[model samples]
Target: MVGMEADGKMGVHLDVSTPGYAGRLEVVEGPTGRRVRSASEKARIAAESLMPGAQVSAIARKHGATRWQIYDWRLRLRLGELVLPESQEPLFAPLLVEEAPLPRVTPKPPKSAPAKVEIAINGMVIRTTVEVEQLAQVIRAVRASR
Candidate 1:
């Protein structure tokens, strides 16, 4: 059997029975070997770290892992490298689809008619519709006479 103490040290208790021999108790130091965590176990641990008020240090200790390892697993899960187990399927809101209302089309008002201009050149009065082509000529004549 294997057991871990409060100080975070793991030790194994070995009992051997023989024809005429007494069992011996020996305490080994350090870890016997490296432990490989399965994918599902890693997912569970990573998810546990995300729970409300969950402490990374506590989780790491409970699972014999480091805080950085848990953080890395979370990053991998976000990047899609790790996926949740079958029992922990992802939940999502239903997608809603509806045709958007047609954009409003407002007809522009008719442009206002140009104003009728009256110009007095010296004592002579010139009354004519202000045409773009003749306005320049009228202005030139008035300036030359002045």
Candidate 2:
């Protein structure tokens, strides 16, 4: 007979008087299985699993979950389906801004003296550092004067 006992335990009573049946079968009630984790909890566990040198198996065992569950949660996090609470999220240190050092200014070498050339035209000598084109014009003017 399958029925609830007076002690609040559900049990099965077998007919021990029957041939070849000598033991009574009792069914004890236990806790309901399959815990439901919240999204924040999943996110927290997933984040912990992602930490440096963190072992997924250890984290999952600690949280009464499987490594696959943590992996799924991580996938959900990457897909934006899981959102970690602000307090549980990683924090970054504020950046410090400072003026960069001025670049070194090296002194330039002194400029070399311009080249000088002498030209003797119509027995009159000319020496200057003027450009070739300007010197040609001056020579032309001198020839035209004669």
Query: Which residue pairs clash within candidate 2?
Result: none
In model 2, state the lDDT of residue 107.
67
Task: Identify the leading candidate in terms of lDDT.
Answer: 2
Q: Give the TM-score of candidate 2.
A: 0.46
- Provide the global lDDT of candidate 2 against the true structure: 0.77
Local accuracy of candidate 2 as per-residue lDDT tens digits, 22-51: 467888788667898899889888888887
Best by TM-score: 2
What is candidate 1's local distance difference test score? 0.74
Clashing residue pairs in candidate 1, if any?
none
Residue-level lDDT of model 1, residues 1-146, one tens digit each, is 23322333455433434343455679899877667888778878888888778899999999999999999988887887777888876443467999999999896555555446677866787776665555678788878888
Residue 95 CA error for candidate 2 (Å)? Answer: 8.5
Provide TM-scores for the models. 0.39, 0.46
